[model samples]
Target: MPNRYLGRRIGKYRVTRLLGTGACSWVYEAVDQDLEIPVALKILRPEFAGQEQAETRFRREAATAARLRHPNIVYVRDVGQVDGTAFVAMELHPLTLGRRLALVGSLPETECVRLGIGIAAALAVAHASRVIHRDIKPDNILLSQSGDAVVADFGLARALPSGSFPSDTNTVEGTPHYFSPEQARGRELDHRSDLYSLGATLYRAATGRLPFEGDDWYTIARAHVETPPSSPRAHAPALTPQFEALLLRLLAKDPADRVPSAVALVDALAALPSAPAHAATLPRLGSRTVEAFRPQVPGRFHRLLTAAVFGLVAVLAGWMAWGRTSSGSSAAPSPRPTSIDSTGNPTARGGAASGSGIPLASSGPPRDSTRDTTRHRPIPAPVRRVRLDLSAPDSAQLYVDNRLVAVGRWRGEVPFAPRLTVRAVVPDAPATCHTALHDTVLTRVTPGQRLVIDLPVRGCAVVRYRVEPRDARVSFLSLDGGNTLETRADSAVSFSLPTGRYLMRISAPRCITFSDTIVVRTSGNASPLPRKLFCS
Candidate 1:
């Protein structure tokens, strides 16, 4: 079926093709006729136009997000309504962070840092405006052609009326997998909630897994409220200590434990590269006990002892090299305070030689046996064995390294191979509604470390609902009858559905049946479904 909106003109923008469809609205690749430039036009689904509060909130918050005017935020071009359709126009990007992650599981530590900095900076701007982006997930973060990370879809953002930080809302919103603990419990929220969400997003980017997962939204939400997230390093062992520390701090269950504000978050991210490389717990290998050492600058006492020992060894070695020629070569000058450069070269600093003023060798004294011994040691390879727990949709074909491993849900151990590839494909459906849906994780594992790889028949998107007449009954049936939902009235409910068209019908004893079709896609949040159902 073709999109009816394509080739249609709304306000000054002409819809080109459907970019994506979500619970609340449909985003289209469009051109601004006035400016003759491309833009992404998000139009409220016809069924939701009657939702005045949702519409007002969408426009109000979108305008607030547009006013942010930050380099890392998606630039909004215009906001208005034509006839009965309300739409927002924004700068179009080639892809989203979610899409990139699907194509390539996890990103390099350096790249994650770069993207994190931009996202934090943008959050800083939004926070300054007293605007809270209630939803900060992978889908809402866009990636420009220039590779810059830009935050999109402030559809869930709300600007607080007062200057006091925390605000109260009766509804529990946001994607389940990325919800903050407070958000999960429907408690008062502040900027810290957004920080926690950002942490979850980065956790996924760095580990190729959600900080918490469950069979459903309620389960995932419960996990956020009660479970301690697994350390990011447990999944991606190659992450730097600094990166892991920052992520852990961001993911702290208590809001107070998170970075104070986006400004502080910016500082934390900026310091990642220069932060000292402290002790890091390396992932366990097969059955070998892991070994780790804290690499720190020695204390004054230790430094003095180390210098005395190295000085004695160096003097002896030099004396051995030139003992015959120079009879009275004054004792080799005491070692000076040394500093290690970026390239690992020890450079002399502080005071010069004390006892032997005789012009000393500039080539630095002869190396000692201790120095050569420690520098030439080789690191051992991890033992070749692994354990895995694979979860996929029923009847889905599971493959390891392109070889058939199992069909449907299978939990079993597999042998370790360099560059392990695990994939799951459903017989007829797409893995995810929008993307090709097969999942791939490129990670090194150990027999003691169990890797849980989950593949789905199709990825689900969230749509919020609110029905009127507390007694009214609301339900949804997909065009193919594969998905059916029965939801409550007058409250926020998360309706998870795969990509497809569904018929929505609402009924009350004395009211006429209100029926409409909803298109569910991989982006956007549609909420408070139809503020009130018309009664006849």
Candidate 2:
């Protein structure tokens, strides 16, 4: 990822802040300094930009996407190299289908079907051009301010020759939730694969959940390959039989069994009754056409906060009421003593004096002769949160058990793990203190314990970074912080770091990564270690 690109120009586009990140590139909202208009720019990662296969695919994305002219497709404006990085500029939508889904976990059946038809129309145009979008997740779909759905991001599109299977095999592309069984197997794919992915997306839109839920990606991928998806109706019981039938047919493992083409899929959606009191009319991907368009995702924070406030109020009220009763009773001077007897019951001190001048029984029920001996119950220990406050050299990063949990002075409940290892490192330069820009300390901390590590620096080192292939993507991983960009092979990147032993890992795509202990000297700026890393 680029550390700083704002105010930089790639052709006519001037970079601003990041819009969002994706698997292939980092997208930024930019302004065309020439046209004085806003546009979205996607910069290819250095690793993917240099590889021959990746570059060819990137070029195909630009060319194939540019060939299309449709209302439902994101229009590509320009594509070129900018400052050693490859980028594509496209019309800015400002909103995405993913963001909409985040707000609306699910959609009404009619709304879902309408969206499906709109997307299918776009896919029909792409498939007609012999291009198959390998990645068709909801994030790739953009929404105009008017709510019209526009399919975007053709970065993974594959061009197919007439009447032939593409040579790509043993390559799996697409989101895990939408991957077809054939894709999970790394088999050749055609336009039909996009239909299956569309079905998966539709399933989520209708049910608010994926067909398969797993703890991790590997398990989900395995389920996609080995297990049949749960019936969509299982999650969305309101779905009509006709709707469920078409969805199941689209999701069939065999491509031949799916809808013949995107055109057919659109036709099927159009055939369904889109307007009726029972069927519920849903405007086809139009602007938030009606005020009834409400998000399905429920916000829990407000409700929880209200409940906690009420709970605290109730507890305080009860405690105050109890104190008032105790005070009133004390003033009245009850005959019974406040002290408890051996049986754990309140008894009178003066031979259990009572109002009638006769010894009275205990306040509660009488003890049974057959009752067992009373055993003292040890008080239960209360579970409490252990606060963490860590300290290191200024800009030092911290990690617990290989997971970067804190930086600088951080306070948090101790992580739940046996033999917690607390490590600290200071980066030669401060980017993010979440990773290992410096060395580390492996201290074993027990769960439910607090600790403060004042890590002292041994002293500073002026180290220079040199990588080959000026365009080759490289990054310095801080054991104490998150990943940050390093100086390109052309730029002589050097930093004055706190003197301490540190482990810095340098990695690039299409090349083996180099990892080792780099010790900085205790005295003044040490001689530049003549170590040059090469990507081979």
RMSD of each candidate?
Answer: 19.4, 18.2
Q: Against the unseen true structure, what C-alpha lDDT does each candidate score?
A: 0.72, 0.67
Clash pairs, candidate 1, are: 24-526, 432-437
**Model 1 / residue 283 / CA error / Å:** 38
TM-score of each candidate? Answer: 0.52, 0.52
Tens digits of lDDT, candidate 1, 1-536: 12445445787886655677777888888889888998988888887887987797678756876788877889988888888888998889858899899999998887787777778778877777777898999888999887768998887787787667676766798888887999888888999999999999999999999998767988898888878889889999999888898899998988888898776676577557632222012121100111111123336885586468557767987888787547546755455555544543445665765532223236876533333222444434555666777887665667665445677877766667656777765433321233224657666554556777787644456667767777777777889546577776645366666756789888888787788998876563655566476776
Q: lDDT of model 1 at residue 437?
A: 41
For candidate 2, report its TM-score.
0.52
**Can you write out model 2's per-residue Cα lDDT over 303-392, one digit (the tens) per residue?**
586468557767997999999988876774345534445655444556443444223454667744333223334434555545566676
Clashes of each: 2, 14
